[model samples]
Target: MTDTKAQTQAKSADAGHASAPKEHYDIVVAGGGYVGLSLALSIAQASDLKVLVVDPQPSERLRKDERASAIASAATKMLDRLGVWGEIGPASEPIRDMIVTDSKVSDPVRPIFLTFEGETAEGEPFAYMVPNGAMVGALSDAALKAGVDLIECDSVKDFAIEGGMTSVVLESGHSCTAKLLIAADGVRSRLRDLAGIPVVRMDYDQVGIVTTVEHERPHEGRAVEHFLPAGPFAILPLTGNRSSLVWNERTDDAKRMLDMDDFTFSLELERRFGKQLGELKELGPRKGFPLGMTLARRYIDPRFVLIGDAAHGIHPIAGQGLNLGFKDVAVLAEVLVDAARLGQDIGAFDVLERYQRWRRFDTVQMGITCDLLNRLFSNRSDILRHARDFGLGIVDRLPGLKRYFIEEAAGNRGDVPKLLRGDAL
Candidate 1:
């Protein structure tokens, strides 16, 4: 790992900002997506961090709710730290319970049905379902309140690591230098590439079809996960009896599915989904994304660190992608804030190493778990099918084991951050 703090100071000194009189910031976060924005806000609240957020999207036009949604628990706490949770609370939905089942077309039978109920020590629910756009809006508002600088409709045209500091040139012909540079630019991060950090990539040969649907009957705060031959079909609870669906299928089949008419799509969805919710109506257009995993060989270099999808991308089988990103924000924020409070070099390798140690294991575990689940369930083999269904049945019958799985799914069982534990940051 590179000592970001030393590199930052060295770069600042080389840039001679103190002597030349130029605009500089303590931290510059590239890519204003969920992870980037959340991190900027969290860091800004802890210190007069002088954070700058650079993105190509206009802030005013980023508020429209998208069909995509995330399962938030730990993420909620991170948002609370940034003071955006309350703003998005009204539009969010609580998931009180979840059902996991193993189904087969050959037998047309469900061999196992497992139900997990959520629990929270606080008055709040265990997890929330939030739309992507709503999350972005809340983060944007919180960032503004924290006095973080926002550079919209702009992208990093070039970045160079020299003399200990990283200099980034924006497409708008603006140049900025920062003690530390964090890339939340997503899985295909250009910055990470430019920094020469290689990633181990795995393609799952699967595609996730995501959309929201309104059912005749209320969801009653219950979500469902059906393990089918193609992949898992997850129906996450949303507000007003609506459910957000992430249906994973074969890559080639998914392309055809996206072109499916509403009537055909609804029928196909209902087949795996069942008619438990009575009649179902499509709420909006459906979108699909290819599923894959990517883990950067290194999480940090001198004056640079990766967060969110940029650091790791996993299958959505567990709906942990964004939640994991939230964890990154929480851990990175805590580490950086503590370092700053001690007057430690915030960009030093020592400070950045703390974050890497905290998150790397967790990220690898999650990636492997999701990959294994994808493999175990996404096959038509009878032996594996029987074993998985039997495993589900066994867990369902064991109360203690069932509760453990529930808590894990709810993002409550871990070395959690204070914000995730519902404490003030």
Candidate 2:
């Protein structure tokens, strides 16, 4: 956090150098993943900025993807601004309520330690379970509608900055220029490395197994998080009779459990997932993602900026990972659009620093909170077990405190950007 824009750019200078220009745009975003795609779409909507999204996958693959994201309420508003949420919202499941429990997977009784009566506002629930396919399909359609160009099956091979422009070269043997370059690539970001950005990487020695389950009985828009000894097992409500499951376990245990035969895996899954939801069946394929935390030393360097996972990767203990990326999207888009409207150089460190300064505190706070929570609850120590549950019980009894926590989880905390507040940029 102490690193200044000048120092970071100076470091980047030794790393990457740009030459000449050919096809030009107002902005060239590297990596057309969710964060990159959302930012590009937002920028294209707010300004006459010619934007290009470079990636290695076509739109069809994105649409057919099975991954799902917990879209915090604030992020839903941001997506609404980009004109995609409306298309996906219908299929998204609103989290009308939530329950928290603490116990071992082998325990007979999983006592509910805390409960939240949902809906932060009228007709607005705390969050929604939006499938990645719906988001990808909506964003792709919206991006095309907004006249944003898509360079599929290709990525930024490298890029250089000269004068006031950043020239980007693709692996497809093409070069283009943009006033500003942003890296929404991912947590393991090559652009971040090329820009000489250092990140604090902390591996949790755990992995999250994600999949959906269909239950015979309805969830009634309810969600549950059971903090077992291994990790938090979440039953997040989705559209219809299905719910998304994020089951975390130690790295070694995860590998062994996943490799088990279907009958064994279902039994293990049922242990964490109770019969309260009637019978349960695993839907589709299950995937495991290694858990870790990564925070870039700096968010901006020269004309290049980092957002989404490229900026920070926190634990899913709190479902705020995607929301944090959307926060970055909202603030960066506002800064860039305002600068361009003022006829200022969007790539200037002076202009880019404003976005960094706006976001750094919030990002760091969330990352630290998640890391601490994962440690606090993902254990069986008698002291922490009793301490955290006592804390949760107190919060549950206090209406005001519970509302504050709900608002925070909804990403409505602190000074939020207009777009996230459901306002147009």
**Residue 325 miss distance in model 2 (angstroms):** 0.3
Model 1 residue runs over 4 Å out of place are 1-22, 105-112, 122-124
Worst 10-residue lDDT window, candidate 1? 13-22
Candidate lDDT scores, in order, read 0.81, 0.87
Candidate 2 per-residue C-alpha lDDT over 190-236 given as tens digits, one digit per residue, 9 for 90 to 100: 99999889999999999999988889999999989999888999999
What are the models' TM-scores? 0.91, 0.94
lDDT digits (tens) for residues 9-120 of candidate 1:
4453343212121368888888888889888888888777788888878755677756656656766766765677787878888887777888764446654468777655
Instruction: Give me the displacement of residue 362 in model 2, in angstroms.
Output: 0.3
Give the C-alpha miss distance for residue 5 in model 1, angstroms.
Answer: 38
Name the best candidate (by TM-score). Answer: 2
Q: Give the worst 10-residue stretch by lDDT in candidate 2.
A: 12-21
